[model samples]
Target: MKQLRLSGSGGQGVITAAIIFAEAAMNEGKQVVQSQSYGPEARGGASKAEIVISDEKIYHPKIVSPDIVLSLTQKAADKYYKGLDQNNGLLVVDEDLVPNIPDFPNVVKVPVTRIAAEKVGKMLFTNIVALGVLVKLSQLISLESAKKAVEKRVPPHTIEQNMKALQLGYDAV
Candidate 1:
């Protein structure tokens, strides 16, 4: 099984990213389990979403230790990155938002939100960008599946920009 954990602020759309990832995995005929949680606020709070994908049956729906951890906010990087064992998995963080990351192996620092706002013309597409980065880095699902999921999930009018954002993110790493 490949476990993925995505975390960021409430409005950053981590949950949506997880759903997109799950959908993509399902499109590829993989067994997937997805879940999420929010910080103590209704908005602008810390949030996290987890996905477990396996070729076989998934006995446990929860993520004990993730194979990939993507943190788009400082608080999320601080909270979630600690659980990742240095020798066990990879950590991907938004360098612009979550600065001051401790030195660790398998750590990738990308300016995700910055790229979205500047290149995509809106920070609103951060989740799709992040999802693209996730899929590209993990290679757990084909990029085509993720694009299909994005097309299905995002608003029809924004599909063009979202696909661009996804492509930019995929080429980021």
Candidate 2:
């Protein structure tokens, strides 16, 4: 089974990104389980999501220690990066938000938020770009499947733009 966790502030789209990833995995005939934790407020609060994907049926939905951890904020990074399995896994972080992460052999620092803000005119695309990067690095799912899942999850009018954002992210790193 491949376990992953995504964490960021309340409005960074971490939970939604996890759902989209799980949906894409399910489309590929994998067994997937997803869970989320967040406060009642929609802004300035901690939010996290966990996803487990396996060829066989999954027994538990909770992520004990994620094989991969994606962090968009310093708070999220501080909370989850230490818990990531470094033996053969990765920690993807937003470099713009975090300047110095102690050298972890498996960690990758990407200026995702800055890249999105520069290319897309807002940092909202950070989550999608980060998702694309993870998909590329892990080869967990095809970009085509992820794009289709995003289309299904996003509003019709925003689909085209988000797809471009995903592609930009995939190509950026």
| CA lDDT for candidate 2 | 0.86
RMSD of each: 1.1, 1.2
lDDT, residue 147, candidate 2: 96
How do the residues 19-103 of candidate 2 rate in per-residue lDDT, one tens digit apiece?
A: 9999999999999999999999969799999999999988877998789998888888888888876688688888888666745
Worst 10 residues of 2 by lDDT: 96-105
Q: Can you write out model 1's per-residue Cα lDDT over 57-120, one digit (the tens) per residue?
A: 9988889888999999888888887778789788999999988895668799888899899999
Structure candidate 2, residue pairs in collision: none
In candidate 1, which residue ranges exceed 4 Å CA deviation?
A: none
The CA lDDT at 19 in model 2 is 92
Candidate 1: lDDT of 57? 92
Model 2 compared with the native: what TM-score?
0.95
